[model samples]
Target: MFCSGCGQALAAGQPVCPQCGRPVAAPPPPAVPNLAFEVANYANRVRALSTVWFIYGGLSLALGIVGLAFANSFLNGGGFWMHGPWAHGNFPFGPGFGSAIIHFAWVMVVLRSGLALVAGWGLMERAPWGRVVAIVAAFLSILKIPLGTALAIWTLVTLLGYRNTSLYDQL
Candidate 1:
């Protein structure tokens, strides 16, 4: 007989389920898969992928912060020797050119990190808007190649290709 608690096969006269330790009186309602089970399974997979987005967003934020710190230090320490002619103020844009580039990098980093965090949150909550944000983010992620491509594919499949439309609507 199958255990009611865990659905593991139970030998005759067994008092409790070995997998779940729950008492089993009869076979599970049926060995058949039901809609509830399928929905739960799909939701779990989506949540798992959402966790990946959170980690990616955090790393992006950290990397950006580090870049900002490095830029600030470099500017204050007068460590511009690597700029060649620009180091000697020979460039047409003057010495402020490096600062402008660093600022632009900081802006891009902030935008990327913010979007990632929002997308992660939305995916975890199964929000409809979050799905849209995640789709856009995934498309952008594809441009990153390799790892990003894999993540984007997984995210797209979990959110867009999921079989149950009702589950997301309820969430």
Candidate 2:
């Protein structure tokens, strides 16, 4: 028989190609993930998600800093940080406001970055839940509005490129 992959000749009953050393028999196709592809695809998704997390996380962190600055201004009377306090609906120097704003912003940064780091690490370890986590995180990231839209679109592209497969196959 002829070896389809390399165009080599094989014995009628042989299961593999002697010249190229590849399986020639029509054995059942491999599983959906195909190990190597699964690893690669999962890694790619993790990377993409990481990028999105950084982009949005940076913005969120910056906004949180602004909130902190506003709260600080209240301590010594509203200044630049107090600009348009009425517009933002913030009370100048309210007790615990500065610390609260700072903590809130830092929490946002930690939340996004932590998830991304975990996703990447899990994917590297071939955790079955990594892909599921990535998909869920990607979806939640869409709440960032324009930036979130971009993230969601990029994630969709990655998923489409990888094709339909199980969470395990993904990582």
Candidate 3:
């Protein structure tokens, strides 16, 4: 029978849910195609995430470049070489230090972009590890400060609020 908690098919003669670890009412039926659907769903999420990552990565790279290049113009007291606490927060600073600082920022963006590329492709194929990748990537994105926070918040909403759009789990 189907598990009420996670919907994972229970194995025959099993007493507890394999997925949720909850007590089962009785022995379950054989596992079914929901596994297939789960994998496929995860893959689809990867593809969608890939597109988002690439887009944001590019934007992050560009913003970093601009911040660095025009550090003085955007300077509020901060400069390319120096950062005040609360970057997005109110502080004395320039846009950034300089081109070098921009380079560093873009480098981070590039890494995220690369991760997206890899996860997107693997997810499209429903690779067994795609879920892990997504989870890891989601965590990493949270560290990106403004960008990471935004991504993390949105992903959390998508994962928790909307059951129909479940990220990795499927029918």
Cα-based TM-score, every candidate? 0.70, 0.47, 0.41
Candidates, ranked, TM-score: 1, 2, 3
lDDT of 1 by residue, 1-171 (tens): 888877999999998999999997954476788778777887888788889989888888997899788775565344745465445434467677767777888889888888888999998988888888988989888776776688888887777744645666655
Native-referenced Cα lDDT, model 2: 0.62
Report the number of the highest-lDDT candidate. 1
- Choose the strongest candidate by TM-score: 1
Candidate 1, RMSD to the unseen true structure: 9.4
Clashes of 3: 18
Off by over 4 Å in 3: 1-46, 72-103, 143-147, 153-171
The predicted structure with the larger TM-score, 1 or 3, is: 1
Q: Rank the candidates by lDDT, best first.
A: 1, 2, 3
Candidate 2 lDDT at 31 equals: 73
TM-score of 1: 0.70
**Which residue pairs does candidate 1 place in steric collision?**
none
lDDT of each: 0.79, 0.62, 0.59
Q: Taking the tens digit of each residue's C-alpha lDDT, what string does model 3 give over 46-155?
A: 56665665566567657656665565344333445545563442544543444345566557757776665555454455465654564566677787788767766655
Q: What is the C-alpha RMSD of each candidate to the true structure, in Å?
A: 9.4, 9.1, 15.0
The residue-by-residue lDDT of candidate 2 on 116-169, one tens digit each, is 555555544556665566667667777768876777667555544434344345
